[model samples]
Target: MTTSATTNAAGVATERSSRRRGGLARPTGIPWILPALVVSVGVLYYCIGYTGYLSTLKWDGASPLQLQVGLENYARMFRDPIFWRALGNTALFYVVTFAVQVALGIVLACLLHSRLYLKTLYKVLIFVPVVLAPATTAPVFRQIYAPTGTLNTVLEGIGLGGLAQPWFSNGTFALFIIISVQIWQSTGVVFILYFAAIGQISPEVIEAARIDGAGDIRIITSIIWPSVRGTTIAIAILSAIGSLKTFDIPFLITSGGPTYATEFLGTRIYRISVQYSDVGLGAAFSIVLLLLAIGTAVLIQVGSRTREEKAGV
Candidate 1:
């Protein structure tokens, strides 16, 4: 009996210890959150660090050290007039497009925010441009901008043939055509975002403004503008960033043509990396683009946060 009792006690103790060990094995803390973080860090390191490393090496698309010129690519970039032109063109596109996009988005959002017939249909139709693939749209616009294309046809029929010059051939006009296409394609996205933000404004707030003898214009300028300020800033930032990285439309429509008049940073990088086979220069340009993107993003965040805080106060 004594031997049997001792054996039973030992078995119970072992089972209790096993249960405790199992409970400990199941995660109770930060270890559970580590795998995702490790994966993210690894990805960031590979992309960023690898790019930086490549930028420092003079690779001729075939090998890493066919021509080892330390910082020559970067120095050459400073002396390249075409690079300056591309940078300036990108800035111009950003400024002009951002202004037009914001103005149009605000107007459209306000118009459609009201009771209208077939509101859903209007929304769908307007937002349809935003959903189309960029690649497909670019080539279609290219055809339209051709010398004897539909645009010139309409112009001729309207007795404005004198106004129809070669669209993509003229340096002055090429960037403008590209900008128009971009605005047409991108404004709908801004419209949807602003529209959603406007919907969140309380009807009661508008009613209160009405009771206070405020007109539509006054209400929008005072209440609506102030309320949607965050969204507006966000849209501006996004538009600027998008413009800086613009490649496809310009590449397809103008090919940064008419003497490099519309050569954006993105196109320049592609030319250097692919066309010229200057991997080092391309990598340097890529780094510049990356820095510009990050810096612009940071500025936007700071500006938006500041405005939000002031508005709150």
Candidate 2:
């Protein structure tokens, strides 16, 4: 009986080993991934290749593709003063909006994530703006920023009528007003991201920190921030890219007006392509915008990697 049992056990072990080896040799999921890969490649090639081909031509939308002014459109774009101003505006929007949104988001996320009452209601209210369509929000804000609009009326009612200026008409304040509107609409996204990251942190770790007499600020700085560094980096990159490609609000609200004070590359591209009928110049602008976005994301990724490596993470 003992001999028979020993033989049966040996056979079972060998079968398990063989099954493990087979599983390792044949990886799964490749069949499911090929369709997604094909679709992504097709879309990328169609968009990028067509845009690049159009950039070298000097054809209006109605004309045949006969005139080939290689790189002249790009040259013209670089020499245009409006282009420089738009670029500067894009950078400013990215920097200021990104800083304010992230800071406000972090604060809000921490508050909501804590043991505060009515957390669910606070989260719903904060996140409501994110789900609203831009079409709806843009027009509402336009009216609110109008001379005799809700904002001005409120300011007058509060006995601060002097503080209420033409929010969208003045070149000096148009960009800042637009920036504030963007922050108001999008800060909820950043808050949710940080909130999710904060939730992933171990409760035991936080409890231990509290036991060691670490105050709330110190705990956040020393533990929470480091733990969510990856999320912060991702949000930063996303905010920068979104700011660079900002179009709808600025275009719809101001039409890049008040003497083109709020013009960005996105609006500029639209004006060149659709309004001015200069397809080639618009294509060149699109290419430049694409390159700028890619370069910024790459730089951020490299910086992140360098920091991680230096810290032995």
Which candidate number has the best lDDT? 2
Worst 10 residues of 1 by lDDT: 63-72
The digit string of per-residue lDDT tens for model 2 on 46-136 reads 8898898899999888976558899999999999999999999999999998899878888898888788999999999999988988888
Name the lDDT of candidate 1: 0.86
Candidate 2 vs. true structure, TM-score: 0.89
lDDT of 1 by residue, 132-239 (tens): 987889888877888889899899999999988678888988899888988999899988988999999999999999999999889889998888888988887888
How badly does each model clash, as a count of residue pairs? Answer: 0, 0
TM-score of each model, in listed order: 0.86, 0.89
Off by more than 4 A, model 1: 1-39, 64-66, 306-312
